[model samples]
Target: MKPINRRSNAPVFWGLFGAGGMLAALFGPVLVFITGIAVPLVLILPADAMSWPRMQAFAQHWAGKGLLFVVVALFMWHAMHRILHSLHDLGVHAGTALKFACYGLALLVTMTAAWILVAVGF
Candidate 1:
C-alpha cells in the first residue's frame, strides 16, 4: 500500500504542551507554596504578597505582563491539548470542530488576558 500521507498541526499543540509543562513544573509548586501555603499561613513570604495594589503594580510592569501572558496562555494551551486528546481517547472523535473549540477557547482566554494586562496601565 502506498504510504497514506497525512499532515497534522499537532506539532504546534505539542510544542505548547511541552513548553507549558516545563513552565508549570518550574512555577506551579512555587506559586502554590507562596499563594496557597506561605501567604495564607504567613510563613515565608509576607501575607500581602498578593495584595491587590501590589499585584496591580506588578501587572502594570512590562516584564510582569510578559510573564503573566506566557504563563496564562501556555497553560491554557496545555490544558486544551490535554482535553482534546482525552476526548479522542474517549472516542469522542469530533475532529476539526472539536479542535477549533479547544484551541479557540484557549486563544480567547489568551486574548482576554492580554487585554486585561494592558488595561492594568503600565
Candidate 2:
C-alpha cells in the first residue's frame, strides 16, 4: 500500500488563497472608484426628471453587490487568518476558542451583508 502525501495540499491551498487575494486587490480599487465617482454623481444629479431611468439602471447593475461580496469575503478571510496567527504567536493556543471567535465574526458579517443585499435588491 502507498502512503498518502499530505504535503501536496499546501500548494493548492496557497495558490487559491493567493489568486483570490490578487483578485480582491485588483477589484478593490475599481469598487472604490465606482463608489466615489458613479454613486456621488448619480446622487448629485437633479432628480426632477430625465434621471429616473439612469438611476434605475444603476440600481439594477450588479457590479456594486458583486464587488462588495468579493471585497468583504476576501477581507474577512485574510483578517481571520492573520488575526488567528497573531493570537497564536502571542501564546493564545486555544484552538477551539480562536475558531469560535473567528466563526462568530464571519457569521455576523455574513448575516449583516445578506440583510443589506436583500434590502438593496442585490
Candidate 3:
C-alpha cells in the first residue's frame, strides 16, 4: 500500500475555533450577566459600570483595544468555521470557494476591527 497523504489545513481553523470557544465560554456568561441581568437590575454592578464615557475610555486604551480585537476577531473566526462546516453538512460542497468566503470574511472583520481600534486613539 502506498503511504497516505495526511497533510491538511484543518488544524488552523480548528485551532481558531478552539481558542474562540474557550474565550467565549470564559467571558460570555460575565457579559450576559452584566448586560442582561446586572445592568438591567442595577443591583450588583454599579449603575455606571458600562456608561458611555467609561466605555469610551476603556476602548481607547491600548490593552482594551487589544482585548476587544482578539475577542471580536476570534469569535468571528469561530462562527465562520462553524458555518462553513454546517454548510457542508447541509450538502453545500463548494470546497475552496466556501473556505475562501468564510475565512475571507473573518479576515476582513479582523482587519476592520484592528483598524478601528487603532484609529480610535488613546
Which scores greater on TM-score, model 1 or model 3? 1
| Candidate 3 local lDDT, residue 70 | 88
Give each model a TM-score: 0.90, 0.55, 0.86
Question: What is the clash count for each candidate, in the order shown?
Answer: 0, 0, 0
Q: Give the range of the ten consecutive residues with the poorest summed lDDT in model 3.
A: 89-98
Q: Residue 15, candidate 2: how far off, in angstroms?
A: 8.3
Cα lDDT of model 3 by residue, 1-122, tens digit: 97879897889989999898898899878878888999879977899988989888999988889899989999999999989988888999757888899999999999999999988889
Summing lDDT over every window of 10 consecutive residues in candidate 2, give the lowest-scoring window.
8-17
TM-score of structure candidate 3: 0.86
Provide the lowest-lDDT 10-residue window in model 1.
2-11
Candidate 2 lDDT, tens digit per residue, 51-96? 5665455444687566555567556655665576678899988467
**Position 73, candidate 1: lDDT:** 92
TM-score of 1: 0.90
Clashing pairs in 1: none
